[model samples]
Every structure is written in C-alpha cells, then in structure tokens.
Target chain A: MSKYLLDKFLYTVDRDPELVERYREDPAGLVTWWESEMANSILNCHGDERSTWLAFTDEERTALREHDHVTLFEMGAHPFLTLTLFIAMFERDHGPLEYQIAYGKAMEHLTLPYPDIAT
Target chain B: MATVCAVIASTHHPFYYRASTSTGADRPPFADEWVAKIETFRETLTKARPDVLVMVGSDHFHQLWLDNMPQFLVGKAPYFDANWYNEEREFGLPRMTLAGDEELATHILRNGLDADFDLAFSNELRIDHSITCPIITLRPEADLPIVPIYTNIFAPPLPRPQRFVDLGKAIRAMVESWPSDKRVAIIGTGHLSLELGGPRQFGEHGPDPEFDRKAVEWIANGDLEGCCGDVTLDSLHLPGNATHGFMDFMLMMGVAGEGQKADHVDSLDLFHTMEAYFTWYPEGVPTP
Candidate 1:
C-alpha cells in the first residue's frame, strides 16, 4: 500500500477534473472533453512537450481486468475523482466487476508516483 | 565584411538577489547555478557583438490567450519600455525602428503550408519576454535594432515535427536568397530539463541530467540530424509543465542550419538541470 501526501500529486488531478472524470467511465465523452482539456494544458507548457501530449488522443488506454478495479484504493486521486468513483460504485445498477475493472484501467495513469523530491 | 545578425533565444530564467535562492522557487532552474550561465550568455553576446539582431522566441500568457490567440505572430516594431509581469528579466535594449520581413514572413507562410503546416500570419502581437529576455541578457549594456518571430507551438496543431526542420531550411534559403549578405547567426533557446511548476519542480529530477547531457552532446557533435530529430508526440507528453516551449527551438533551427557544429561555451548544472546549446557559429564563419 503506497501512501501519497496530498500536497504533492494534487495538481495533476485537481487541474483537470472535468476531463479526467469522463475518461474514467464515459467513453464517448472522453473524446471531446480531452481534446479541449489537453489543448488548454498544452498551451500552458514550455516547449516540444506541447506537440508531444497531443498524441494522447490516439493512445488507447490499456484495459484492466474486472477483478482489479479499485478506485477507493487510489490514494493520489483528487477529491473530485473519489466522488465520481463513489457514485459509480454504490448508486449504480452495474455489476461490481465492471466498476472494479474500469477503476483499475483509469487508476494506472492516476497512480503514477508524483516523483517526490526528498532531500 | 559581411553584415552579421544575431538571433537570441533562451529559457527566460530570471535572477534576483533578495528572493529565494532556490532555483525553482521564483522560476525553475533560474536563480540556481544557471544564474551565472544567463549572465555568461550576456557577456558572450557583448563580446561577439553582432551589428543587428533578429530575436526568435515564444511568449507566455503575456499577449494572447482565451479571448484571443494568433496562429503565428510576429513583432517587428521597436519595443522600448515594454511590460514585465513576473520578476523575470527586464528588456535591456533601447527603442529602435523595426521592420517586418513581409518577404520572409510570406515565404514562411507559403513554405510552411507547402511543407504541410497550417500557420496564421499576423504583424500585430506584442513583443514577449521570450524574445526580449535573451535580447536584454545578450546585450544588457546596449539595445540593438531588431526583428521578432513568434510561433503557436505553445498553442496547438503545432506544425508537424519535420515542418520545423524545413522551416529552418526555408528561412536559411530565404535569408541567403535576399540581396543583403547580413552576418547572421541563429540561436535556438529553451532547455534540456523537465522540471515545471509541478510539486517536484522545487527539486531536481534524476532523469534531467541525463537528458541534458544527451542534448548538449548532440549539439556539440553538430548533430543537426539529431538536434532537429523527430520530437514525436508521445515524448512531448512528459511530466514537466514547460515541455511545450522546446518547439520554439525548432522554429529557430529553421534558420540555424544543419551540420552546424556548436562548440559548447558554458554549462550550469544545478537541481538536475543544464541550460546549454552549441556555439553561435564555427570559427570558419567570419565572426563578429
């Protein structure tokens, strides 16, 4: 179990909640939302990375198996992501396995360590 | 004697005394050891002393965003008493007349499209710190007459990777094609590090030194083939917040030329960062 302090990885999630939310479950919405969201983020960056991130549109997120979906365990997610995950988990009629698998796929990108700087 | 001109570009790393000496505090990698490097660039520029300079660099949210964004912006007007939002470096040049190389700009647009790029043409954007930063640093003691070019690389649909290389070839062809045999030395600015405003920005990355070393090595080896190598879309999506700015270097490279060996003159390493590039030109070329 990896622990994440809030201050470190917060911006990666907080800065783009609306788009990250859709990518978590809404497949159709993910396409349109990410296009504009990525544009906004890339323009703010420094250099070649601008054109670099644009490639995300073509990258298919690798899917996780049904048994592995676990949004609650994602320690670094923004408060909004947790909220979305909660609603999808309890209030929905979908099978528990679907949420489990979906959460797993999304969490991989989410769980990447913040590359913490420790002196 | 050929009339030589300079193109100044850089990371716009600001240095201030009273502020936090932590490099990433005010601006990542600025106040740290790179402070001396930026000052050294100014010194070398003073020594090399070109007659006229056409600065090539990018702008932040300084001029365009949200309400307005120009596809491709160019500023050929004299900028005296320009604005500086952050404590970044101030413009060091006095106001002078500026001319739009409508000929060059038109050629870029035409060639950019022929080379499969979409660029909006404009003559009315404000001169940004990206251009003014290196200008003031290189010639802090005096202001030189200037021409400026801007790219939407920070924005989107950035010209294809190869297009940047062609842009360099196009500009060189255009410059030499012109009757004026100006003493021209092109500069490609920006960095080899990936620390941005993210949390890790306060500290250095383990990978940054490796990245910096590889980049400078390519530059010194005159690896124009590698320098302007394909900046694939996947690599651009790295963690740093400022990775987008490197595209501006490609725009400058359009004029810098291939097989041009860069003799590294200075390198400042701190917090896993290196602010460096090849020499302005080889000894064979008549230097200023």
Candidate 2:
C-alpha cells in the first residue's frame, strides 16, 4: 500500500510552514505537485540520489488530496504524523481542541486492533 | 563512583508549558493544580542535589525520520537546541538550548554497547518535547548539564517491552559506575494510555482510564514482574494505539529496580490524558 510513502508525504509537508499552508489552501494541487516533484527526492541526499521506485497508490493520492484522515488511518499511515499535520492545518478554525475532538469522532466506527503501522 | 541520586519517570505533556504559563482568562482551570503537583514533584529532584541528568525520551519524528530510524540512540553533543517549529506552532513551547554532558553520554554509549545493546550515537541532535516537557515541569531553570537518550517508542517494529526494562537496568548500572563524584538524576518521560490519530483520541479522559490506573500502580509499587507479565507489544494496542509509549515508563521501572517503591508518586487526571510523576531514590531519600 506504500504506507511509507504516505507517511513520507505527511512528514515532509508537516515540517515546512509554507507547505502546510499550501496543502491546506489547495490540497489537490499540493498533492499532485508533491507526488511529481518531491516524492522520490531523498531527504538528505542531492537530487541525483533520488529513489526511483517510490510512488503513491491511487487511493493514497486521493486520501492526501482529499485530506482524508480516516482513510489515512485505515491505510496505516503513521497516526501521529496525520494528527500533528492535521492539527496544524485545521485547529485554528475551531475553538480550543474542537478540531481534535471532532477528528477523533470522525473515526468512531474503527475498533482495535487498529491497522498495523509497521513499515 | 557516581551516585544515582534519583530515578524519575513522568508523562511529558507538551501542553503543560503553555497551560502553566498562561494568564487571566487565557489560563485553563487545571493549570494551578498541575503546577502545584509539578512543584512538589520538582522538589523530589531538587532535594537530591543532582549535578548531571541522564534524560530519557523518545523523538516524535523530529530529527530522526523513517529513512534510517535507530531503535536506541544517545545524543553525544556539546549542546542540544531543544523544541521544534511544529512544537512551537502546536504546543507554544519556547526555544531552549541545554548544555550536554559529553562525558556521561560517552560513558553510556561505550558501556551500553559493551553490555550487549547496539545503541546509535548522534553528534548533533535537536530534541523534542519528550525531553523538554519534563525539563519544564521538573527543572524549569534548565540548569543541569544532561546526557540525552532517545528511544523508539513511536515507531513500529519496535523493540520488545522487555528490552526497554533491560536498558533501564543497564543505564542505572552504567551511571553508578561512571567514576565521577557527581550526583546523577536519570529522568525519562512517556505516556500512560494515549491515543493519537485514533477513534478514541482527545476524549474526556484518557482513551483507557482503567489501564492508566493499573499502569500507575505498577510504577508506584515497582511491580515489574506483574507489569511485564501482562504487557506485550500486541497487547498494548488494547489500551490505546499509542500506548506503546508506556514502555518508556517500563524502562524507568527497570531503572528503579524491582520492589523499589517510589519515594514520590503523584498523578493528575487532566482532560485527554493523565499526567503521572514518579521519583525513586536509589541511595535512600535525600535530606531536604
């Protein structure tokens, strides 16, 4: 399912302020641009050292483009990454933890044992 | 030989710094009680007169990424620049730089490796709230030089719960044998029953209060036998998806040793999660 790539997308986007805003403002545009331009570029290495095989599945891309945390969790993308990035992007709109509470309630149907997050 | 003054474990709630420091209507109702409990907890370490600290905490995907994650890592730098931008954005944690004790970091790395643990070493490390949260709650002055140890509690394919306990025991031994006269306080922080990005998260209480109750009793009384018998990598998910972080507390239980009752134990049942603090005096309680 390329959960690692899904997490890598969240990890890279969450750390940069500009990217967080861009992703929030235009999820579809950011997702397309990230998959094409930034997906294979190794974090610490030069552009030439990029890994060629890393790409998101259609569902994974759709989940990111839609900002679908529920699908991300079901896909076993790292929960902490999803929660942190989502909070940064969305928490400001709501009053004091309202976003966090609603975020959890969204997946009320999911039960333990949650999806395995192992890479 | 160095004296292991205090073996302390706690919940590193990132929201604490903001909560405790806020004023007027901005301050949450629970801040006062949290601060009071923390002040009492802080005195447990202060009374011991520790000169150096061995800080045990896990990195929450800050500097160490999935590309090449280490199971256990020791930061051996001259200094550590604490807190991150995301932490600032989310938790409102201020930027801090704490002095690093390279000698103790070196001793732990060398001895920890010799003692059969393959630990990774970082010459430059920027720490996250896992380490700083305790620093804020317990030692606000942030004066003591520290040796930072990062564990992999967040990532999967994690080491067994037993490994965390074993490492704690090894750390206690290593510190006692460091050949320095400095009094060292070994401090570690982790969660009780946390659920992040799960259906059960951000609830009125922790995702599982029953688990939190049992977990606190296990730590307070130093019941590693009972704790280890019940806790497993797979079983931790029953309490909460993020409950694996409880292993860091188990690691401290190892440091406190079996049947070594904590001298100070306190808990605050805050919204979303419970905050528990524990302190054990390996060489008997220090005089105030």
The top-ranked prediction according to lDDT is 2
For model 2, how does the per-residue alpha-carbon lDDT over B186-243 read when each residue is reduced to its tens digit? Answer: 9999999999999889998998999999999999999999999999999899988899
True C-alpha contacts between chains kept, each model in order = 0.00, 0.90
Q: Against the correct fold, how does model 1 do in TM-score?
A: 0.57
Q: Whole-model lDDT, candidate 1? A: 0.45
Residues A38-104 of candidate 2: C-alpha lDDT, one tens digit per residue: 9999998989888999889899999999999999999999999999999999999999999999999
Model 1 stretches astray by more than 4 angstroms: A1-119, B1-9, B16-36, B78-81, B86-121, B205-207, B227-230, B282-288
The TM-scores of all predictions, comma-separated, are 0.57, 0.99
Off by over 4 Å in 2: none
* Two-chain complex of model 2, DockQ on C-alpha atoms against the true structure: 0.93
TM-score of 2: 0.99
